[model samples]
Target: MFEYQNNNYENRNQMYDYYQMPETGGPACNRPSGPKKTGKAGKLVKKIGAITLSAALFGSVAAGSFQAVNTLIGPTETSDNTAATENTSASLLKAAAIPGAASEKGSLDVSDIAETVMPSIVSITNKSVQEIQNYFSMFGYGGQTIPQETESRGSGIIIGKNDTELLIVTNNHVIENADTLSAGFIDNQVYEANVKGTDPANDLAVIAVPLESISADTMSQIAVASIGDSDSLKVGEQVVAIGNALGYGQSVTTGIVSATNRTMGSNTQVVNTSADGSALPTYIQTDAAINPGNSGGALVNMKGEVIGINSAKMASTEVEGMGYAIPMSRVSDIIETLMNETTRTKVSADQKSSIGISGLTVNESVNSIYGIPSGVYVASVTPGSGADKAGIKKGYVITGFDGKTITQIQELTELLQYYPAGETVEITVKIPATGGTYTEKTLSVTLGAAENSNNTQTESGQQEDKNNSIY
Candidate 1:
């Protein structure tokens, strides 16, 4: 089974191929009904016409599927009528194209699509440091941790660029905890990349590579992907997936839209409601093979327009060809926001800011048990600190920091690593309302210097320090 951050991905059954043809003739304002004939011969002629139209429409979809199969395997000879049938099918396919969506509603050549779209796709490499505790510490020896560097691979789509950076979009998990990020472009050259911004709740992130780092040759070789309307997507429509599958560089896989508007958790499991406080995200389910390294890849239509971002795949011994993607139409605005966020670097420990609050993580379980808001439950706010000065009370739950949503004290702590001392940020809190209810309030707080960073307390009243502390 393919595993991405140990999450289980899911997908459901597909839908029908073609749409029902309209019986009415032309526009309603100038509509005209065809002359009716009562004779049995006339009825027989109408039946034959209906069958011919259905055959042509069905033949269009069948031809596309056959081409997909042929693209997978070697080609085989077809009957002489195939040419004429395909010509008729093409006309019907065009007539059936969804009105609002720009469609390539005809025979598809997988190789042509791959050649056109691969330049906009890139392979991502994330290098991060993980701490591993010594096993000897369990046997009475002093506990010590070792820093280990790890590398992982994923894929990304080149969306756009700014004055100094080339912006690429990918799944947040692909670059999570990344100490150093790199993008390998179509030119076979790798360049350093920085996280522009991240929406962890949606599992989306935009990374930027400096224009100066990329060679002109590479710049000429790569292209920005053409974005398509996911809202216009129809079930069973053929789509192509391009990604750095298994970290073997970009590869192409073909499939059909199995389903849409499938609500899912950030972990990729099918869920009606998010277990976390964040909003539940929806995905486009397809039969495409989205592998481990395929996370953050492109799911494009036959026109080579990106309609979805390939994120996860359902891998099971009992099921096959089920994958999920974040629909492009749903997150277009989010991507813009991420792209506009100021690129930041982790502040040094000495220069970092502290919110000066002792808080405990309150998740869905805590909310259900205590009837409190799901966020960082502030047990104490230090006097004269930024949080306290901003009118943050002891019982208030910190729900958001700057623009990022916070469900746990650890999230707040992690975010504090980027904002330096004296930088003012907006913090959203849930204040205690009448009858144990909570009302969200946004407060502007100037972060304080980390002078007492080592003297934080956990929920159990245990003394903790930064880097090793839970809060």
Candidate 2:
């Protein structure tokens, strides 16, 4: 579970609840709030203040720095350039001065590591239209949803380059609901971005920028980040964080490995838990400052290799320096899935169906302890969808659907892939009882048409409408 820190924590909670509302209490939409097992694993993650830079490294700058020299004369055009050039020779010289510099060493120059990783890092700005409802408007019956354009800032790492596009990986939360995305380079160049793919379960997303939008000179200077083995990380090892700290350009923070394989709990709103009850995404805990806008930044080791992606941090009056990141090892496959371009394509009306439900696979341990079988737990049912019309109730665990053995929400998603919109399918569910007994029931459900084109499974079994027209 990711911890969000803020003073307006209660207001954020209210906003989160409001996000699940359908414009007119339509039957097709499932409210975000639903009855479920509640457990407090850690403090609630809330708002991170503005201007705070959250990175792993505490010492100085990204890549290298150039000293600006002024000639005693007033500012005027001259044959000599005032700004100095990068000193590659100094890196060599510094490396040479260090003991065993020619071979693998425990530490490398922090500035050099930042300099090397900085070009690969870019700041991202997300602009989305947030439509809020004014229930108190004219006679109360004339309430309407008001659309407001909002802007958010975060950081991303250039991971791959194709002939036509440059791809960067970042937290899904960074670009969620974004109507327009822009990527900014250290040179102050910005490029319009397109959503390549996203997996909110892990809070990961892949955004692509047109290579043609970048200048030839700047493109030549940009480098793809070198990915490292997060499994190889050891506690107490030094690491650095670089990101658009607190929405103000990219900044760096330094710290050591405070802990590893840490589990704050599962964020059911985003993270997908394992069906087998193993392998919850563990975090690399550090003491670095993880402020606002650091959500999608990189956490690199001293060797100038990115081992983790900065995700969340613990912020409170009683807490200090408890930052967290997702291990890079666990991110590779999800990123590759999002990078494939076609994974997030718009769905044709005949290609997909929506059941009007929002649910997720339950935690294995919780299910077992509660005497409930491990399966997809329905959080809420859409008012008049196939599931609701079939008398399917929330809190029921789905064991099978259309003859497919469904033990997890992911399986249910795969099963739905074989069906088309406006198709009727049989659903099998197991109802729980007070005495640890379950009754199996079969129901016929006619799936509804998914809204718009970008119809994809968001959570395990949840199909979130991408079209913002309905607010």
Candidate 3:
């Protein structure tokens, strides 16, 4: 059984409920009545006089103290006590050590960056409501059904701009099956967006909105961020992140480029799990503080160019600050394909013949338990699959597939995708012999489609199933 822990689910549900409620002031504002006077005139007069005298004395003392303080320090040079003295000393030391510290020599003005890039950082609000049906028996004979809703918020960056249309790039999971989507700009203008295309395998999506819907001034000032080469980034290079932090607004956070060319997953299974579960990339690691809403935002270089798209964070209960991004180099390819409408091209027939298999390498612990070598092991075979009909044993250990030596699941998938379908291929397997050692045998089999399982069956001279199980 698979376990799920989605913190955003509850928050989104709460947000939907709050949006449905009407504003009202009930128990929040209430006051008590003032005390009533019920005393003789003479006694009340005396009490009033005493209170007035006390107030006058306090006011005179407060005025005199203020005058004394102001007299000691003139208006031009106001009194700055011990705290200010310590601050002045610290500033003097800092100024003496660094010649250009006080001057804005190397720093770029924030106002300039905001004025240029803020229009490109779009606020994305994706609303997806799963209708939860609740049936309750009313009295005895009838039942009532209740429908609940949930919604979520995320951010995206404007990566494409034509003369008439603007494209916003965001995570596929952000807009996946969304019922409604809205894009907001820095000018406080919101526009309903349309999903242009999505590549769930890559965890990326390109959304579009009409240019006329947004503010004319904002559209004119919008700058399509210049894409930078993520390959050229180093471990210690400076980087900046501009994103909608926690849905508050566009925020800027700075850090150094922690690492690059980092591989997070190895095979197709690994890629599928990571991309499908968390919507993460295969490479590009950074140290930036990438929060929830920062997904699909821009990971910019010091030159104000976007180098990557902020994707995920790797933090535990005990650690923090490890984040990852999809390199802009890969993003560029996806965007270009979407813009050209070439993403729908099908894989070649030759590439589809070689079905990828993974999770074969037995670890030390598994070796001790299974009494097998620490190599790729064929755990199971798809029924009527290419390998199945080829007389390849299910429990038989696979030493290699094609010509490449496989160690992980991802390696197998990548290699298989390179080949086409309906091609005869050879597979090497290790069979348990009379002795403790295994004997290697080569078998030739006609490949079948990856999606069709009924085409594969036990070949002649292969061991048949002991039971009458169709699988």
In model 3, what is the error at residue 404, expressed in angstroms? 26
Question: Where does the lowest 10-residue lDDT sum fall in candidate 3?
Answer: 10-19
lDDT of 1 by residue, 1-471 (tens): 232121233423333344344445554233248886669977887788779778867866777776576654433234434664677555435423222322232434567668878999999999988898788877879789888899999999999999999999999889877878999999789999988998767778999999998999999999888888899988878888999999999999888889999875545543111224545677899988888899999998866688999988765566687888999999999999999999876777678788777778887767878898878887776666787789987789998887887776756776777689889999999999899888989999988887753343333343433444322
Query: Candidate 3, overall lDDT?
Result: 0.61
Residue 90 displacement (Å), model 2: 20
Residue range 152-225, candidate 2, lDDT tens digits: 99989999977788999998778776667899987878888877876655677898998888898788778888
In model 1, which regions exceed 4 Å deviation?
1-107, 138-142, 265-278, 456-471
Error of 3 at 229 (Å): 1.5
Per-residue lDDT tens digits for candidate 3, residues 166-280, read 8888876677646678888877778888776665556677888877776768777665666677888887776777888788888877676778866564232221113422233
lDDT of 1: 0.78
Error of 3 at 438 (Å): 27
Q: TM-score of the candidate numbered 1?
A: 0.72
C-alpha lDDT of all candidate models, in order: 0.78, 0.69, 0.61
Q: Any idea how many clashes model 3 has?
A: 13
Candidate No. with top TM-score: 1
* Best-first order by TM-score: 1, 2, 3
Q: Who is ahead in TM-score, 1 or 2?
A: 1
Which candidate wins on lDDT? 1
